[model samples]
Target: MREVQPVATAHLRRDETGHRRRVRRLPLVAVGALVAATAVALPQFTPDAKAATTLRGYADGRGVKIGAAVGDGPLTSDSGHTAVLDREFNSVTAENAMKWDALEPTRGSFNWAAADRLVAHASAHNQGVRGHTLAWYAQLPSWLKNGNFSASELNTILKGHIGTKVGRYKGKVYAWDVVNEAFSGDGSMRGSLWPTKLGTGYIANALRWAHAADPAANLKRFSDLGLEVSVTELDVRIPLPASSAQQSADYKPASLNPNE
Candidate 1:
């Protein structure tokens, strides 16, 4: 097995003195590739071949919650992966196991095997589990995507799916990415089966359905509708072989938001 190199992680927030300070720093382990988002990078603290503070330890000391996008394969198969996960992070988000297609691939026949394993692992480790998503435009089951259901029928199906899936993990999950990437890059609603059939109200409906299933779980990121907002998937991607000047400049925008 290859060793993962540790890099510093910073959570920028204003202190009581109203000055921004480096409250936490962890060793970053680049996990794997991602598509539109950035790669999964798990944090650790292994320096100079000796014992040191872990990512979770450092974050906890500073009153911050550090997390990583974990894959079910690694959680079950790789000891090193789990060791890093259990020690370095206090929260886990399923990379794909909790997606729509993975949960209900054949309309009514739901499969909770992989997702259950993830939740169970988190529970065993006393770590919080962040429900990946309740609604998204991608990774939809073929039955739901290709079926010829009317608007009313699709809305019912959406509500049922959210209720069943969210209800199953009600108290176990702490938060959910209720609706993922609903808008396009150009600031317009993306074309999807839900919007095409049930209209844009599907986003609001999905949020309500998820909340009904688990009112305690935070279904944030809808500040426009008077809901709280959260910043997830923080990354600064630069072109390959970029100069240090270019990379530093790219991160300026992210620094503007203390929450980022």
Candidate 2:
């Protein structure tokens, strides 16, 4: 197992009496990798040691554990392969696999039959779980497609969605995808009606509300809307980014027209 250690240091530009002061230094981790890049020389290793390391890495030991991910819904369950996956992995990740829309298709209606089973199974096996996707622009319910609501109404709706979901799985959730795809790859914040109406603080509010409901929640938000964007001119000149990027959708079944 590779141990992760952090190093912290600071440098003083000038003395306090003069003008400049010392600034804090960020911690750094030093770890060597065998195959960091596609082309790189590997360390000299005897055949015996190489095979041993490979076997040991896959064994349960004192190291960072891996987890399997499967949506807990009517269409999925912890069976044959999932049981093995749950046993092998120590954590799980979800994008829109586990979100408000998928769980609660209708407003104020809760569905826990599927997720609860997985949560219970994880707890029984001592495995960690990741609750994905609380807020985002896509994968929303049909009602939100073109429905126009006031600022206050929007805020209420967004908050309600986050609070109930995060609150329900507070204790068991390892971390959360608070808001996904809310920004461009350039690092600038993404645009959404919630931000325009409720303001930039909506992010802070989401985190706060999530924390209040689930104080122990570990929040992870993403906003890279353009990271893998694709523009289409087939329908009303729908504008987007390059269609060959890492996240392009030119060949997606959910493209312009599903039936097409």
Candidate 3:
């Protein structure tokens, strides 16, 4: 008979300042015995004496990928900051270069210089790129928002935008946040222009169009193919007249339940 052994899993929590606060350990209920029974030890080889000492090196040692959100200003003007970013992170996300307004400020004309520079830098450094977003409500040009168009016309416009952007960076970008902030805090879809103009089906159409544009994208599972949503920005607003202690308590680190 094979001996049954317990396997431990850790859940790490991050505080408001992006620091690891605490770790909670949980035991795997199933597959723990099988894992222990089939576990094998391989001969270990020592790493180089003068191994890399940066954050990216540390993450590589532990088989993890670390990334950062960067802006065009530092990438172009600040060499020191750019050096630190390149040396410390294996992946990069453009803070605003790939947004709708930046890509297509005027109708039927596109500018790709700023975003292209970032992509070129990341490629030179052998770092993976994450496209910020494909469709969003804010930061949109005045023309897109104020233009007079029917639902069908808007649908065509949305598809064309997704195809142009995603197709341009098809193989270069590893992941894309196809849609952003689609939901409110109350678990309902936010009242964004997409839903208001094109109805709920617009999200599905957006994902479909993105996939059609870039069939080779490294998306999630099939069910979640083009719905690779991300919480790019998170803000917590505390009411006034609150004490420091109360504010601190309110800012407690969020807990993640890995079992779920």
- Best of the candidates, TM-score: 3
The Cα local distance difference test for each model comes to 0.62, 0.48, 0.61
Per-residue alpha-carbon lDDT of candidate 1 for residues 10-78, written as tens digits (9 for 90 to 100): 222212222212111111111111111112122233323222277777765554456776666677777
**Model 2 clashing residue pairs (backbone):** 66-90, 67-89, 182-223, 183-223, 183-225
TM-score of each: 0.68, 0.57, 0.69
- lDDT per residue as tens, model 2, 37-62: 11212122222433334322343343
Going through the candidates in the order shown, the clash numbers are 1, 5, 0
Q: Report the Cα lDDT for candidate 2.
A: 0.48
Question: What does candidate 3's lDDT look like per residue over 56-130, in tens digits?
Answer: 666556644456766677788778878878767766776667888878989878989888998899888877676
Q: Which candidate ranks first by lDDT, i.e. highest?
A: 1
Candidate numbers sorted by lDDT from highest down: 1, 3, 2
Provide the lowest-lDDT 10-residue window in model 3: 29-38
Ranking by TM-score: 3, 1, 2
On the 0 to 100 scale, the lDDT of residue 125 in model 3 is 81
- For model 2, give the RMSD to the true fold: 18.3
